[model samples]
Target chain A: MIRSEQIEPCAAAEHSGAWARRHVLDIEDFSVPEIELVMQTTSAMKEILSRPLKKVPALRGKTVVTLFYEASTRTRGSFEMAAKHLSADVVNMTAQASSVTKGESLINTLNTIEAIGADIIIMRHPLSGAHYCAAPHVKANLVNAGDGWHAHPTQALLDLYTILNRKGRIAGLKVVIVGDVKHSRVAHSNIWCLTKMGANVVVCGPPTLLPEGLKTAQLLFPGIGVETNIEKAVKDADVVMELRLQKERMQSGLLPGLRDFIAGYQLDSKRLALTKPDSIVMHPGPVNEDVELAADVLHGGRSVVNDQVTNGVAVRMAILYLLAGSREQ
Target chain B: MPSKVVITSDEMRRSIARMAHEIVERNKSTENLLLVGMRTRGVPLAKRLAANIATFEKIPVTVGALDFTLYRDDLNQRQPSVKGTDIPGTIDGKAVVLVDDVLFTGRSARAAMDALIDLGRPEVIQLAVLVDRGHRELPIRADYVGKNIPSSKDEDVQVKLAETDGMDEVRVASQE
Candidate 1:
């Protein structure tokens, strides 16, 4: 249970501005104030999670439909839990289980979900910009879980929340993201979110795994450092984030070999020693043990991967609460 | 809109001191007693009541803050941002006095009761308000009321506490 002294009414008063956006497509569309507002709301949701009775009646009559075209454990499960915690009815659908198997078009499938009276549609499609394509056709608010390698706004927000929870601040912190930067939607969204909040973000990966527009991205997100050297990237860092290495990338010849990648980028205890003493390690999970992150480092004291999962539910709850509330305002 | 001050700062303080005495007398003792204040102005008023009780009883009472934004019945019509509920300890078998600044329509009091029940099974629950303006839609009444100002449905009764509004006063103004 939360202490009565920790609950501050003035904190809620600071975010009196009404939420403006309807759909959460990407981190690029979010302003600084909007991101801060989400963080503040997530703090309140976290307090609810601490209670013995974890349910609330805020979204009593609303329905949430989660449509996933890709495989996800943490994101989908947390979103479902978030909706259930808020007392919103949730319907989960995967590509194999849904009408997508019957060759239903994305827009048509979305309309069908809308017809079922969904107040919010949380979808994870494999195609980039899918939420943008589906947002215009549906009356329900759209939240992109992950679109190809595009963006995962909720994941980014939770990562931000976890970082802020541990460090107590974000500005001027060095956050090094290591692994498949090109294929990881987590990295793409984190870059945008972290940079916007005044963090010095560094992307570390092999030349082939790094994004092609690295130079141009630096221009867009100022103070972003691209380092191929893993040791140099983690040096004196505040936060070291490890992106899961997708095994499919190896078949495409993007990497030399698994052993070679592990030798260079695996975040073992030795590699973790290079960062600041109080620095935290994060991984957007389904982590490949001993490949991207070593077993010891994964279970290390500095690891906040579990906290990230818990914060994911809170962040999603905040997103659903804000989006649903904005419709009436 | 024309408004007139109903209760001055001194009157508000005296009313809180009286309410504290009444709470102590009715409950027989402050043992296992909790003062849970509704969000915003109610929080400070609860603290003030607890402070007064501590002055006379020589034992401090536990104070908590309850935010019922999530338990609202009109959620589908409008959703307010959640401030959060924080109880210092378990409410099971404890006498809870819910403190608020004003009682209007009694809907918020109803919501607060529902919220409290969800947390734990309190031995008993009582409502306390600094002002009780008439026009209640629900069959709820405050156990401890500082003042009763009967007003029409179109009028608004506002309670400004020094902790929130930087002043202590109760005023009634007509809705424009």
Candidate 2:
């Protein structure tokens, strides 16, 4: 549950005049207070998740269409569960079964879903900014589940919620993001959100996997640190977030082999000892199990990996409830 | 615009004390009695009642806060400012006294009741309000009310409890 005392009342009659932003394109679109609002909403939604019935009719009759151009297991399941828990009708669309294979354009597909009376579109595409380009093409609200490597906002928000729920605050905490920093959309989104919430973020990876636009990250959220040394990056960190190593990056010669990557950066109990005793481990999972992380450490007491998965549903519920649940529509 | 003070601090305290005693008398005992307050103003009022019940019967009454922002019918018309909904323990077979500040169209009460039901199937759910203002759109009614004030549609009944507003008074003022 939320610390109601910590959140300013939902001054709906005052500052939320019109509350008309219908799409969640990226974390960059939200201010710190807005992010807090989402967190507070998620906390309330979590109570519903823990209920005996575990369902709320808040989104009754609302249609949430989840369109994923890329294959996913966790993100897709979480969104579907979140929508169903809120009593919204869910229609899942995938790239393989859809007419995209028959040459239907992205905008055409989105319009087709909108034409079928979908109220909201949650899309994850293989191309960066795919959701951005599709937003103006449909009347239904658009949620960027993930856009190539540009942003996987809900994942990041849920990660933040998980951290805040465990630690009680975000400001002044050191959060080290480890693994495929160059290709992991989860890492990109986390850096933007954690930094916005006043957490010091250090992105650590093998030099080949580190982004050439590292300067852009520092520019995006000033004071962001880039580190190649795993030990230095995690030292004194309040949180260590491990990203799943995309094995495809190996074929491209980003690293010599899985052994090299694991030896250099894979987080195990021994490596975890380098951080503060209370430091928590997190993963945006479908873990590379024992590759990017030691299987034992990922499931250890200090790991909030399972909590992240549970909070994923609550956080996505908040996103759908806020973006789709409105009387005016 | 001049506002009328319907209930003063002393009278409000006496009304709450009377309500507490009535609750004890009606329930026959404080055993398995839970007081659930709606968020914002209802929380403090519920706590006050629990405190008064403890003093009167020398027994502790469990108090919890419920936030109905997510359960409201008007979610589409406005942004919901969510609050904490914390029920200390299960109310499966207990008598729940749902507390709120004012009863107007009865929508908030209905929403809170809906939320409470989802949490657990309480043995019996009863609502208590400080002010029972006129013009309830729903057929809902409060089980215990401090005062019943006939009000016009445009008039807002404002209940100020010392815990939230730093004063104990009920005021009737025009919405304008």
Candidate 3:
């Protein structure tokens, strides 16, 4: 029996009006209450995950298909696990093996999946705004896993869950995102989610690696700080999130060199000392060993990188549960 | 449609005390006994019963809250939110007594059993309900029933507890 020691009788009643969105494309338009509702549902899903029998019949008989146009390991695996844990039938398709290699259009593939009775489609593409093109082509619910540098909402949500689990809150905390912010979908999504939740967000990277319109974008969404100096960005920081630096940036001349980038911006012991004592270290995995973050920091006690992966499944479960059941409203 | 109070606060307390004594008499002692309550009102009732058993037998009993929303049969008809199930420890080889406020359809009791069996094997599983109103759709009968209220199918039996609602009472009203 799956049991919770603290069962709030009015918890379900409180979140009755919390979810109505048919698709989860981005966190830029999510209200605070909606985010809180997702966190609340994630907490409940976490309890289910803790049980010996980590299976729930909430999405039983529902068909969930994961359509990936980009190569992925954690996101695709966790989405598949989340669907399977909820007792849903899952079908996974990759661009390399699927009809995409045969030049089948994205719309035709979506229509084929819909015709095969897919209740939900989770897609990750290499192009930005891929979900917008796919959303209108099918009535099935669409979840954006990661689309170029546009948004990775589930990754941001699990990061938020990890930060909240560690720090107990998101507001009034200094969160410094380190690495190639211009090319990281994780960084973009976290910027929106953290700022919307009242966190003081500061993006730290080399001038060439930072987005071009960041200074002007700050005018639209205030309290977002952009700093080129790593030392100044880590000062009094509460959360230091390291994004994976793509090696292609060096070839593109956006970064001078890997050695220069690491010496200037790597989150090592020296830079970590600048943050608060209780501050946490985070990285959306596939860490580059020593490029963006030190190996010690990635495996240290303060690092919640593994917990973020574990929470990723629960967060996706909550999102799938909410979106699949939204039709009942 | 008119509503009338069927069980008052004082009667609720007395009925709970009697049920506790009956449970102890049937099980012979409170040893290795677990009290699992359905969500909403059954949680407080189980706590109250544990307190009563502790007062009489001087032995504390384990209580758990069971929320079987996922195991419910009406998933396709309506989307019910999950309230979560919480058990303190293992239920293996223990005599479990499932508690609920009112028993009408017997479907919830069946779902609760399915949810319980998924965790572990209990030595013996028994049902204890405060009010066992007639019209059971399944072949399930309570081991200890506080009161049996027989009424028309259109009438609704509402059980409100002070832990949840502002008062403790059982009311019967015509369905609107």
Candidate 4:
């Protein structure tokens, strides 16, 4: 386990003002260097945030656009706060307000953001691979905040930061991601980050949401297992991440009802009982009352859902700070 | 901090030769023996020791690396970051030597021992160090010490070897 005593926070990697060309869309496929680059940079950003006057000039004089066509308060606000902390200007574009509401197509809006001297665009859209489709069209660096069920790279990164901070190491860890595995971008992104860092992973959910034919997780790690039993999946787990079931899950007919989903997949104190003693509980919130997690568990000692939210600012700060400072290896 | 003109690379080579001779003479053979380096610098030192022993006895030597970051109890005292424990080989019933550069805080040595226990129990264990600047907090002692130069606690000793950082030098900088 990671010891949290007297640790002099690491200084951010010396940004030579040459690191402004990087972009993060998915954590599943990030190389070890890329991951470390983010981790090391995040370490320094965390230290910076600990100060009273928390803002930095690392990302000053740059344009960071938050393009979210999905409902999110934590993710969007964290990005806004992080960019603000780094002294960068922010532009928020949701489908509700943007020309995207008038059928302006993803490409046109992305192109417009590009033409407006936008230095960066942080996006979260409901449509799968929408960011990938807009990646080529946008001239500025694109950060996929949450792109449908495909991947939420930054969320996974923040989750990893939580684990690394609490546990101190990533290798040989047993991480179990529970609930809505099929439609969870957090679970998907975690499969890549945890596996890449040499942690054994198990994705467990109800049979309907946890399907077969996951090629990305398997392609990166051929030995990963996908299970359905919450008990068997979470046994001896060092870290267990519970994902919130999107409202679309029921509309998609994958879940029968909320009562049944909670009975099977909810991580209450009883379900949390099955995990390792020192295990930490995590969630990407707006948690369903009794579906994905219980109220007590979310507020209890093990829950890092709140910490996960706070770390989002730190992680994003690291990403932008690193990308803004140096593009050199 | 004393300006100790620490051992040169040639001096290092001779000390390793002597240490290698002592290890072989005491054990009578390399059987059940393994050299495990304690991270960045000790790893190469173990390789060199293994190489020297192989040359002396015409028998193969098993070399492994043990990173102590995970086992450290001082992380909470210092900095919160991820430093992993990577053990590339097994340590079942073997005689092990924990190799390191500077044995100052002794916390790192203590952590290395804890990490080794998780890997497997060794029949016998010993310590080897390139430098042992005595400001011991724990009751640990190095079994094989290349150089024992006493120094103040504020001094930082960095060892660079040609195999790793393209040069062999020991610099003692004042702690910031």
Ranking by TM-score: 1, 2, 3, 4
Model 4, C-alpha of B166: deviation from truth (Å): 10
What docking class should model 1 receive?
medium
Worst 10 contiguous positions by lDDT, candidate 3 chain A: A4-13
> What docking tier does model 3 reach?
acceptable
Question: Residue by residue across B67-136, what tens digits does model 3's lDDT show?
Answer: 7877787776655556677888888999999999998989999999988887789999999999988898
Q: Write candidate 2's Cα lDDT for B76-122 as tens digits.
A: 76666566588887889999999998999999998998988877788
Candidate 1 vs candidate 3, TM-score winner: 1
> What overall lDDT goes with each candidate model?
0.90, 0.86, 0.88, 0.76
Best by TM-score: 1
Worst 10 residues of 2 chain A by lDDT: A1-10
TM-score of each: 0.96, 0.95, 0.93, 0.63
lDDT of 3 by residue, A189-264 (tens): 9999999989999999999989999968799669999999999999999999999999999999998899999999
Candidate topping lDDT:
1
Candidate 1 structure quality by residue, lDDT tens digits, A1-329: 55422322334335536467889999997887778778877888888888788888888889999999988888899999999999999999898988889999999999999998999999999999999988888888999999999999999999999998899888999999998999989999999999998999999999999999998997898699999999999999999999998888889999988998999989999999999999999999988888888999999899999999999999999899888877632
Which segments of candidate 3 are over 4 A away from where they belong?
A1-13
TM-score of model 4 vs. true structure? 0.63
Tell me the lDDT of model 4 at B48: 84
Regions of candidate 1 where Cα sits further than 4 Å from its true position: A3-16
Minimum summed lDDT over a 10-residue window in model 1 chain A is located at: A4-13
Q: Considering DockQ, which of the candidate structures 1 and 4 is the better prediction for this target?
A: 1
Better of 1 and 4 by lDDT: 1
Clash count, one per candidate = 0, 3, 5, 17
